[model samples]
Structure formats: structure tokens, C-alpha cells
Target: MVNFRKYISGITVLASGFFLAQSTVSTVLYTPAYENQKSTLNLPSPITSMVEKAILSPKELVDINVNTMMSDPVLKNATWGFVVYDPKTKKVISSYNENTPLVPASTTKLLTTETALSLLGENYRWMTQLEYSGSIDENGVLNGNLYIVGSGDPSLGTNKAGAWSYKEIVSDFVSGISREGIKKVNGDIIIQTALFKGNISRLPENVVWLENNNYYLPAGTTQEINPANEKLIVKKGNSFSAEKKYFYVSPYMNQMVYADKYDGDGILTTKLPDAPAYLANSFKTTLVKSGVSVTGKVTPRMTDGTPESRKMISAYKSPTLADIVYYTNQHSDNSLAEALLKTVGFQKLGDQTSESGRSVVTEHLKDISFDLNGLSYVDGSGLSRSNLVTPISQVKYLTSLMNEKYYKTYLTSLPIGGQSGTLKRMFLGTGNGQIFAKTGTLSRVKTLAGYMKTNSGKTLVFSLLVNNYSGSVDMVKKRMEKILEPALDL
Candidate 1:
């Protein structure tokens, strides 16, 4: 009461200080210029449009891009097909030319692999038996031919995808022969190739034979091998070509079927005249390296006709059929794929020819209720020009895979984007591991089929096939990537 004026002045100063501190804190917290003004807190139109596009529905995006893809000048005379489906809902989200039949190329491996996985359980193994028809004496000498009867095993000496190695093969066979009390062979080693009935022709693109006695590369690839070291130095070339081709070989390498020739894009490949003989030679060399002495030559024959009294000495079992299929599909391995196809025919139709394999595949597709109005299968590896199928049929087959008991194994066999297999260089920097697919390429045809994971956690299956394109194939791939880009956004 004595100093009312002074008391009022002190209270006003305290209130002003408090208000200033509160204003400073608000300014520090609100960074955007628009945030300072309550009425303009909304984003600008450009930023808002980007946000909307990022969240666009899968169907909406497909619809928008399909039209653009169809109108591109690169596809002037091309027959193209595209389909996207939802497995959970069993519905087609988008499609364009989905019913048109197109050459599938290596994508044919998909059908071959799927059929094999369904018929042959995951743990099924291919067997190569080694036995002798005659007896060994007390001095450890055998008087009969050692026979190798294969059930079309493509993994005998291969390490690319199989679990068995050359060392294991040598050890196992040596042990088996030792267990039979045989220290020396007095007869020739014969590789019987008629067990499967049909003969397989060598693919037109194989060029290199590895030191381990396995053919490691297929057609459509080129590598520069160092002549001095017999090692690979460069591995770059077209996967498919019509006008130009090139391949390389190391001069110091062993186990080669023939000498290297040609240096340009016109390299020609010769058929494997005698596969059984080649394998026999490789095995003979391995036996010699393991301190086994033989006084006989390695030979190939059509039939063993071994008497029923022949004793089974040893057998080499391949890895599980599932693992083999995984490697086949992942690398687009033509040899393995064709072998599996023939195996399927042998199992189902009692015939091992490509035509018979095609029949088996046709029957399988029908059993699965796939619409095969224009589908065709001429060979298991799709190296033949006779294979054809529609995008719609492929989509249906892929969707049906989800309901199968071995669906997980089947899916894992496909090439993961930017992660593994043939798709390692594809979809880089944009969906990378999010896409798992199988790629197919011919001179003028390109195709991609597989499963994709969306940004929203939804899974989509798609098949995009393009054939008879007029421009460069690389250009077509770029356009296809653009068309599929929206799926990543979804």
C-alpha cells in the first residue's frame, strides 16, 4: 500500500520477460516459413502432386503406363504382352496383350522347373552308378569293364550348382572300387548313354570346358581367357545375337572338346558328338590323378547290356532335385534345364526326347487348369524356336504356384533382382532385391516374368514379353523398365 506505483512497474517487467522467452521457443520449434503463419500451413501444389503420385494405386499406375508403352515407336511390328496379378485375391490387376502368344526363350525354364519341382519331390536325387560285371582276383585285378550308367545326371563333375566336387567323385569311386577288393582294372571303362533312350544335342552356344571336367558357360556369352594361365580375364559379351557373335578359350586349358578358332561375332559351335566318351575321358583322368593305374582306354557305348549278375560297386548321388532346379532357373542353365526336361519326359511319358518332354509339359499345364489356347513347348530349354506361350497363361501358372506345397522352394529358385543369378544387374538402384524374376532373351525377343513386392507390402506377379521389336534390344529393355517402374512406387 505504501508503494503501489513501484509494485505495478515490477509486475509489468516480469510479464514482458515471460512473453519474450515463450516467443523465442516457438520460433525455434517452427522452422518452416509457412508454419509461422497458421493460415498457410498446407504444402504447395507441386509437392502435393508428388505425394499423390507416390501413393497411386497399382491398377491406376498400370493403366496409365500400359497405354504409353503400347504407343511407343520401338514396338512398331512387335507383338508384346504384359500382365499383373494379385495371388491373394486371385485377380488380374492390369493387362495388355495378355492373351498373345510370344516366344518365351529361357523363360521356358520356368515351366520346366515348375513341372519338375511338382513331380519330383525336393529331396529327389539323380544317381550315377559304377559297377563291374566281372570279379577281382587275389592280386587286386579286375577283368571286366567298369560301367557308368547315368540317369541323365547333369551334376556329375560340376561345382557350379551341385554339392559334389571332383575330389569327392574321385574319392567315392576309389573307395567303392577299393571296397570291392580291386586295385587294378584289366578292362576298358565304358560310359553308357542309352539309359534315358533319347540323345541330347549339344546347345549351339557352349564354348568353354572347365578344369573340373564340366561345361560352365552356355550360349550367348563371351569371355577372354588368359592363354598363359588358362584363367578367365574378361567376361563381357552379348547374351543373344543374330548378326554378330564372339567367344574365347584358353590355349593352356585341358579337357577341351576342340581347339579354339575365330575372333569375331561369327563364332560357330559344334555339337557334342559323344557326350559319354567325353565324360569317360574326364573320369579316367581323375582316376589316374588319384593313383589308380589302368591298362585300358575310356570309351562310350550305346548300351551296356551288363548281365544281371553284375555287382553294383558304387554310386554317386547328386544334390536334391530342388537345389538343382534352383540353380537351373537362377542361371538360365540350358544344359541342366534340358536335362531336367528330358528327365521329366522319361519319368512321365517313358520317352526322353525333347518332343516327349514337350508333351509332358503340355499335360502338366492342362492338369493345372492353365489356358493353353496358343501355348507350345518344343524343347525343355527353350533354345528351339518352336516354344510359345501367352502372358496370361504365365500369370495364371505363377499365381497357382502360391497354392502348391513346394511354393516356397519354387519361389526361392528364381533369380533375385540385383542380388543373385542372371538378374544381378537388373533393376539396380530401384527395387533391387524387391524383385525376383526369370529373364528370357533371343535375337529380337525379350521377356521378364516373376514376383515383385510393392512399397505397400503387397505382392504382385507379372509377365512382360516382347517379340519382333524393330529397334535395338537394349532400347526395348529400357522401355520395359520404364513401364514396370510404377510397380516399385506401388
Candidate 2:
């Protein structure tokens, strides 16, 4: 419930941080010179008096706008949950069905990311190690299997911002091997993915899978496969040095895989059933091209324990958790969000399964005293329609973070209105630069939750969740914009 402030003469400043002017008419409509000109306009006295008598508080105006939108034909049957809260006064400014749980869409990333940052810290990094099981002889000829150990790093070999490209990663590994005086005879390239012990398929059941799109498969799934009808094609040219030879093959049974002629960056688009195996194959190819012979093929090994004799040769560290969180929130990256959720489970609960991650997030929320009534957290990314949260709960969770140590990191990671990420084209007029929030969208669902700076220089946290609307997504967005536009003056 809101505490309404009484209106006074001249100017009234409410404790709720809104300024009101007690005037016959709005300043925009009635200037000082309008007193003399009012008679010339020949307006009816009753109409002029009615215009002068109409004065509404900010809260009342927002309520009117929300009620009007709720009654609109397009949204007559929609379930809406909205809340605007002030941390300073510890008050709810405006709310509509705030306690009703609704599908949150991508806004679930907010929970996944915030939980990760709280548990993993800002500077935490994921490490992928290059190691060998056998020993190299004095002649640098005898060797054992080379192991590419993974710690469930999602950014490995990705083109994510601030992440190393696959080419660079391979080059570093090759250089490190060469520096160690290892010239030849690697038995095989083994990708070790035992860190996440069981069941690596992280996608929720409700997420839709598209054909010919890139997907992150289980840790040890095989990425490269040759179609029976397609033969490996090798073309020799004058520029092809002994150190570089191109082998083009159909990496996926459904799609062809080829290396960049100039850089050897294998451009892969199909779902990588086994990312580590693909990387291991890449390492084998590069090793052979660099004059190091591999006697065996690439393999993926999933064991609970690594041999004590294995020696680490090199390591690649991912960008810090902060960078990953920023990218996840700004872009609403589903894969990264899932990875972070699994990592949180692995780090805190010793299991990397989705259930474990969900439990971890639920426990974290409980620890923070957030109300769990009518809340259903199914997956890290809200791609699953099973995810549900009330608008009041979201606003409460957001308000609780104001005093946290990582609040700055969390706040800056959200998309800025009309400036960056998903919100770049939104809030282009008055809401521009005043909203720092996350946007969520799914079929018949749209959500927004974050902080807003009002025209009166007051900061407010808000959440607006809508479900089952009978209109285009763009139409819903326009209505949402209208509702938020009035809040800009609060």
C-alpha cells in the first residue's frame, strides 16, 4: 500500500521524493500572460475551471495509466504483475497484482548471475589445463597421451568478448609444448572432462532446439563426424608449407566443416556434441602440422580421477566471472547463464547438474529471506516456461542487493536503456539513460526488472511481468513503455 502525501499551496515536496506545484493549471498550459489571454480564447468557464481543478499526484497518475492499460482490449485477459519500490523510504510506490507469480522469461538470468557473483566472487576464473599422462624421453621422441583437461569452461574456444579465439588457444598450447622441448611422438590427444562427473546435458526440457544452429553439448560429446558419402579433400598449393596443410572434412554428418585457408581457425557451426573432443582434434592437427607426429587418434576420457603421474604443461584461464556475468546479463546469453548455474552447483555443492544448481539458487534465496511463495525456478535461463516469480518478490530481491558488496558489479551489468545491449533501441525518448534494467521475452510473455532514475533524481527498483497477452510482442512493448514513461516523472 502507498502512503499518499497531502497537497499544499505554491509548491509541496513530499517525503516520497515527488515535487508538486499547486497551480490553477499545469505550467505547460497556463503561463503568467495567459491570465489576460484566457478571455480572448472564449473558452467556457466550467471547462476552464475543470481543467484548473484537475490535479493528480504522481502515484495516482501512474495508477490511472496502469488501470487504463489493464482494461485495454489487447490486454483484457493478460495476467500482469508489477511493483515499483523505493529503497530509501522502504516503501512500495506502485504495484498491480504484485504477489502473483508469472513466467519471467530471460529475467531468470538475474538470479543465476547474482547467485554466481555472490558465491564465486568477482575475480573467480575457470581454468583449462594442458597436461600429459606419459613422460617425454631425453630424445624428445617417447611420450604418452596429451590431455586437454576441462573445468567446465563455457567460453573455451568461443568468440565471446574478451575470450581467446580457438586459433590463439591452439597457438599457445603448441608454443608451450615446443618450449618444453617436445618435438615428436605424442601417443594420442585425450580430452579429460571428469570435473563435471555425471549428466552434462544442461538444457532444460522446454527449450526449443533449432536445426543447423550451434549448441553446447555434454562435456565429452564427439563434435566432429565424417559423413559416409563425403570424402576428406586435400588440396596442395605453392603456398602450402610443410608446417601447414589443410584437411577439409564434414565435421558434422549434416554439415561440412572447413578450416580457414589463411589462419586454420576451424569454422564450426553445428552442434558440438563433444566440445573437448573437437578441441583435442584441433590440437592433434596443429601438433602434426608443426612437425610433431601423433601415433594415435583423439579421444575423450571421463574419469573421476586423474593419474598422479600426469604433468601440467600449460593452462588457459578464462576471463573473470565479472566479465562473463556482464556478457551474460547484457546479451541475455542462455548458454552462459546455464554454465554459470552449473558452475555454482559444482563449486558449492560438488555437482554440476541442473537440479543441483537449482537447489543452490533456491537455498541462496532462502538465506537472503526472500519469499518463495508461488515461485518456481526451473532453469537458469528462463527459456523454460516453468520458471515463475512474483513481481513483488523480484522487487524485494533487487532492493535487498543495494547494500551488497557486489551491488556495483551487478547493477552495471544490466542493459542500459537506449545505450547498450538488448535495450539499445528501447526507451529512446524520456526513459533514455534513466533505466538500467534487464528485458525478458518469450511467446506471449514479456518482463522487465531493474533500477530506474526518475526525473526528480530518485532511484527506484521495479519489476513488470506480463503473461498471456493476446497481441503482438511489439504491441505489448508499446503499452509497457507508456506505463514506464509516467514513472520517469516520479
Candidate 3:
């Protein structure tokens, strides 16, 4: 949770630091009222100080430069600057165009995920029930159709043990009938996936495919992907797996096979693929079974519906919201985020449709007083540049989350600074593990906003927004990420 007091303390630090540099730091631009306040407060970082302090409230986040550091030589060639805020005094540290609204990209997930967690709570789970719309005789034969209802649970079959709800659903049905002294169904197996209503063939064309594929599978199913494959796919010669940690599906696995010996939970000894999409198009890959190999085509389960309805036989629980939150933060799992968003909205709107979830969230943000003028949040994944938000709005909403009715549990869902979750390995080995923040990226936009430790050992709230750069988008964002190393290094 963000501290409200830090905001005020930052102002105090900036007020006194302004005059320390006095005549030498006179080049900084200032607002009329803000300048008056600076003079009245008569405070500034002096040249003799060991640390160069800069704070960007709203106006400077959009235009921070390397010059803010007064030391980085590379910043002269850099695209945008930074917003440095002193924690002890809540004031504008040094800033450049902090007020501009830039494209937020995945950073927008921070908004959507936080909103969902705050309003919905972390204990919330998805419900995928096994229902039958057919008549079952005492002999154990189902005369009609077995309806497979979808509760839009993304975590279904995503157990740490590895399985899917569709498979789980069938497994449950088999067990229920076996428990009932029955062996098989006399009628057809009818699956009713009438859960979400929308187009199913081609997904709505968008920039966030990697992010939104979870919740709304093309609004309709076309390609059948392994439910949990979006994350890590451990295969022979795949690069996604490290010594102990397995990363997301990288681009190098389309043409590799695994040795039978790799599955014992040791390590990926083969070379990793350089790219992640190598496996996306290979719908006809073979998997090894019991040290042997088997090939199969990807199949989509039937979701057609019939008039008959039957009671649920067997079902399984999806992953808890706690794990989902961790995924959302660590990998910036947009798909999971979207799935959770729609599930909550579906609960309120009577269905798991994306449109309904979008509506519910938008309304809720409004209820909490989020600024909607520049924010065009469409999907929860932030895959769309169509979605927008200002730094001030981000901080304001974050403050609200801290005050939520279930703040303690909700806070745990968020990743810890350098300690765990997404921030892990970020500030690692830098002794900056105390810093906790979320990283969001997209072309032309990047953001690092959350909590950070300040010079005085007091907690500080920080939001860094970098937009409108002219370099390779990824490289440009890398520069944005590097800003935090120094900001939190103190």
C-alpha cells in the first residue's frame, strides 16, 4: 500500500532544497505558483550535497532527461528525462514535462489489476461447473447431452501439477459415473461453452495478443492452445527454462524435442530458442510419452448447446486469486488479468463477456474518482495504446487501493520490491530489494510506478512515465528501466 504521508513529506524536502543550488540551478523552469512557493519555502539541493535530489510531481514525469541527474553523460543523447522526488519533503524534486499524458501500455495493467483486486478481493476464485442437460437412467447412461459450462476460469487445469479444465471436466465426469457404478454414456457428449457471448473466429484485431489471449480467446475459439502454455513450456532444447526458474514461452521452441531425461525437474540442458513465437504456429507438434514419442493434432472441444440440461457431475477448482495476482505482476500476465477482470464483471453483469467486464471496471474507477479525460482504458491487459492514464491519476488510484476494505490481503497480492514477485531480480544484488514497483512496457511508452525508499529512510511514492521517444521501442524502454536503479539506489 502507498503511504499518504510521503506525499506531504516530499513537498517539504523540495521546499528547502530549492535554494541550496540557488544561482547555479536557476535554469530549471517552474510554474508561477510553484515558483512562488519554492521561494517562500526557500529550499533546494545545494551543489555541495552528496546526492542530487530531483522530484517530478505531474509536470516533469513526461519530459525527464539525464540532466536531472547532473551526472549521467549518456542522458545528453537520451530521448526523455526523469522525475526525481525527494521523499522527506513532498515537493516537486527537479522535473521536465511531468504533466504530459503519454501512452501507458502494460503499465495500465497496474490500474486494472489493482482495481480488480481492491474491489473483488484476493480470495475470489473462478467457478467451472460440470453440468448435464441430458437424462441419466438408473443404469448410468446419459440419454441426452452433457453440457460443459465455462465459468471463464483461466486457472482451470493450470494446477502446478499440469492439466486443463476441459481435460479436468472429462476426468471428473468419468469419476462421477464410475462412482455411480456406471461405465459409459449411451448418448452424445454435448459441450455448452455459451459462457461468453462474442465473435469466436478472428479475435478483435488489437496490439495486445500476448496479453489478452487468456480471458477472451478470439471471442470464439479457433486455434486450440494448451491452457497453461502461455507461460512456460518445458521442452528439450527449449530456452524458457533456466537453472531453477522457468520463464515465459520464448521464440525458440518450434523445432526442438526433449530428451526423456529432462522431465525429472532438474534443468534444461539444451540450447534455448531466441524467439518465443516458434511454437505458436506449430499446431502439429509431437509430445513424448513414457520415453516414447507421439504426434497429435490440436483439437478444439465442442461447445455446441442442446435443449436438454443436467446436473453437474464433477468439477475442479481454478487457481486462487493470490497466485493469479502473482502471475499478473511477475510476467505482467495480461491474459490472466483480463480473465479475472471479466470474471468479476461477469459476476455482477450476469456473464463473463469482455464488454460487461469493461463496463463494470470503468464505472468502478469512476466511482473512486479516477480521471477519465485522458484515460481510454479498453481492455484490462493494457495491450492497446487506445488505453491511456496520467501519472497523477495512477498515484491517486493507488492511494485508494491502500484504503480499500481488504487492504492487508490485497497488498500481499502485489509483488514485493526487490524481494519477490515481478520486482525480484530487478533491483537484485543492488541492495535495493526494499524497493517495490511494477514495470509496464509498450512501443513509445514505459512506466515504473509504485513504492521506493528515500534518502531519509522514510517511505516515498514514485511514478515514472516516459513517452514519445524516437529510438527502438525496446531499447528506449530499457533506458526507462535503468532510471529506477539510481532512483532507488539510495
Candidate 4:
């Protein structure tokens, strides 16, 4: 007696009603924002109403990307990004592609440094210890081999390595050995740098600033390699024809008396780094005109690290782990990042080997609990395309840094905008640097991630990452830098 057609119609209506009801469920449930107060925000219609009402009816935060704003070709084409967070309301304002994982380039360092700060601390410095297993006498003469141990010193045999000259490290080793009442070593000097345990790749192919052959950490191997000293290399480049040739000066203890003229052209690639490699290689170009070579000489090394380095006496005591982290964040040194990653692995896994170290770091990051899928990390130095990260996880890592005691120190440790470090002169005229955040870059990827206050004076964390795009990075950089300026007027 029942009508089958009627019953079917009834069920269909019910399903439709259910779906419509579900659609009606407010998005404000997830994101915190004042739909009305957010009227000023340039967003879609549905989200605008939702946000407007949420401000009137409730108070909280979340991100809702159930819209086409992000997928919109115009916006998406202009900036390959998704941002949802308000510094003013301390909540997620809007989002698109929020979950899509994108390569963050150097922005990944924010995560590495921030995670390191929370787990490692600000007062931490790398320790370069000196161990000797030989006999010394009152005559200041060593009768055995002097072992110099390295644990990934970012600033060894380079000025930033320790503010001391390679000569000083040598002198310190001699003085320390002398203090230990020893001179005239009768045994070989063995430099033991087995601290880091990983395969380090060699320097990049486009390297030009090897002002000194001291930028020794190539990519594929991982071990605590020590440069001879804390030397900031200086190279002067001359534009010979349309080509450039450079002469390098070592951070010798002796003052450089370059009182000569009659050079090639006026281009001094000075301030080249001595160690922690990449920075040193940053000073060059290829022989475009062909048949171009450099003819520069060291004032005269006390003696390079040839077979003779075996007899050099020295001590190896690194700074605290915290100091090491600060230096890494501030200077943005690549080799140093590799060393720290290994150290973290060694610290966490209890095995000072690269395999274990990589595992430890990976495991620790997983413990972070952010949903980062398809993100692979082989080394800490983002030098590897094998490394991957999502915007969400990196932000989570930064948020975790808040729990640290020296978090302020950690914050400052980041290169400031337009002031010092990597970011110096970048956003200097922005007036925004009176307060704001960080920047990171590498081949094909550009990212700006960090904290900044909104127009309401409430600080909000944001990250903008652009990857795999074929265009002018310089233009992209300009566009990215301009976005943060007047928007909040910060």
C-alpha cells in the first residue's frame, strides 16, 4: 500500500536537506575573525559575510579555504602562496592552498634555527675542543702528536669563525701547548675532525669566491672539518677586459700592506669569507671572455695545510652550542648549518655519526606533529632539493620557539630587516624593521616568513613562499618586499 516513488522522493529530499544544512554550518567555527570588522580585507563574498558575522556573534580563530580566492588564476599567478593569520586578532583570517606543501627555500632555515633555539637554547655555542695524547716537558717541547678536534666549526680558519686569525688559532695552539709547558713538537700534529657524521657535498658549481682554498666543506661528506683559522678572506677583483680576475688576502695576524696601484680594473671583492665555504665561493664569475685567470698570492702563508700541517701544534675547543646556533642564524652560513644538524642528531641519538644524526633530526621534526607530507630532509643546509617542507610545519616550528627562555635572543639572532646579517640593507628604509621578521633565498625559491604586527598593533606570524617559477627573482623580490610595507603601514 505504500508508494515506492513517494518514498524515494522523500529520501532524496532528506539527503538534499542534510547537505544544504551542512553547507550552512558557519565557517567561523574554525577561523577567528570579525566578519564585519574584516570588511576592510580584500576577500570573497561568502567568507566576508562569515567573517563579518563571526565578529558580531563570537570570538575565536581558525582558517577556512572553502572558496575560490586562492585558486583564482590572477592572485595565484602573482604570488604562489597561501596566507591565513592575523597579528591583530591573533587568529587565522583566511586561506587557500593552506595544506599544499611548497618548497620554502631558505625560509626553511627559520624552522631549523627556531627548532634549534628551543631545543638547544640561545646561550649555546659550538665547542671546538683540543685533545693531546703526547708527552710535554718543562722545556715547552711536545714529544708526541697534538690532536686538533673539530665539531663543525662554522667559523674556523675564518674571521667569523672566531674573530681570531688562523695565525691566532696557531698561536693559541702554540700558547696553549706552551701553557701546558711544551714547545718544539717532536711528533706529528693530527687534526681530528670526525665530529660531524654525514656525507657532505662539495661546493656549488658556480662558486667564484674561493679567495683562499680554505672553504673546504664540499657537499657530499659529513665530518667535523676544521679550517686553519678564523679568517675573513678579502678578495679584490679587477675587470680585466670584460672579464674579472681576483686577488685574495688571508686573515693573517700581520696587517696587509697593499700599497700598489697599476692593477686591472676597480672592483674589490673584499670581505670574502675564509671558511664555512659558500660565502667564500660567492665572490666570482666564469671566464666569459675565455683565457682569463687570477694571479694573486697570499702575503705568504706561515705554511699552508700541506703535508706539513701534520706537524702544526694546536688546540680545538668550540664555543657553546648556543653560540654556534646564534652565529648560524645571524650569518646564514651553509657549512655551519650542516655541522649543527649533525650535532643535533648526535645529541638526540647518542651516536655522533651522520646517519644517526640525520635520523635524529628527522625524528625530532616528525615529533613536532605538524602534518608535513612529501617533505624529505637529507641535510639541514637546504642545499639539497631532496629536502622538503610545508609552510604550516615551518610556522609551527617557529611557534614552538616561543616556549624558549632566550627566545628574545633567538629572535634577535635572526638577521634583522635592513640592519644587519643577511637582511641588512634589505628593508632598511621600511621603518618596519623598528619591528618585523625574516627572509630566506636560494635557487628558484624565495621566501619571507616571520612575525609582524598588524594595523591593530597585535603581532601576527606570516610566511610567503614562491617556488618553481620562471621569472625575474629580482622583480619577484621587489614585489615581495613591497607587500609588507604600506598594507599594515608597519
User: TM-score winner among the candidates?
Assistant: 2
Name the lDDT of candidate 2.
0.73
For each candidate, what is the lDDT? Answer: 0.69, 0.73, 0.49, 0.47
Determine which window of 10 residues in candidate 2 has minimal summed lDDT.
210-219
Question: Candidate 3 vs candidate 4: which has greater lDDT?
Answer: 3
Q: TM per model?
A: 0.74, 0.78, 0.61, 0.60
TM-score of 2: 0.78
Task: Supply every candidate's count of residue pairs whose N, Cα or C atoms clash at under 3 angstroms.
Answer: 2, 2, 54, 60
Which tens-of-lDDT digit does each residue in 34-141 have in candidate 3? 433423111223431222234543222222223332233223343332345543454544444455465666667676676677666776665555455556577655
By summed lDDT, which 10 consecutive residues of candidate 4 come out lowest? 279-288
Once fitted onto the true fold, the runs of candidate 1 whose alpha carbons sit more than 4 angstroms away are 1-56, 163-168, 200-275, 282-301, 304-308
User: Tens-digit lDDT track for model 2 on 260-287?
Assistant: 2232222222234345666777788898
Which candidate gets the maximum lDDT versus the true structure? 2
- Which pairs of residues collide in model 1? 205-219, 245-265
Give the CA lDDT, 0 to 100, for residue 386 in model 3: 69
From the highest lDDT down, the ranking of the candidates is 2, 1, 3, 4
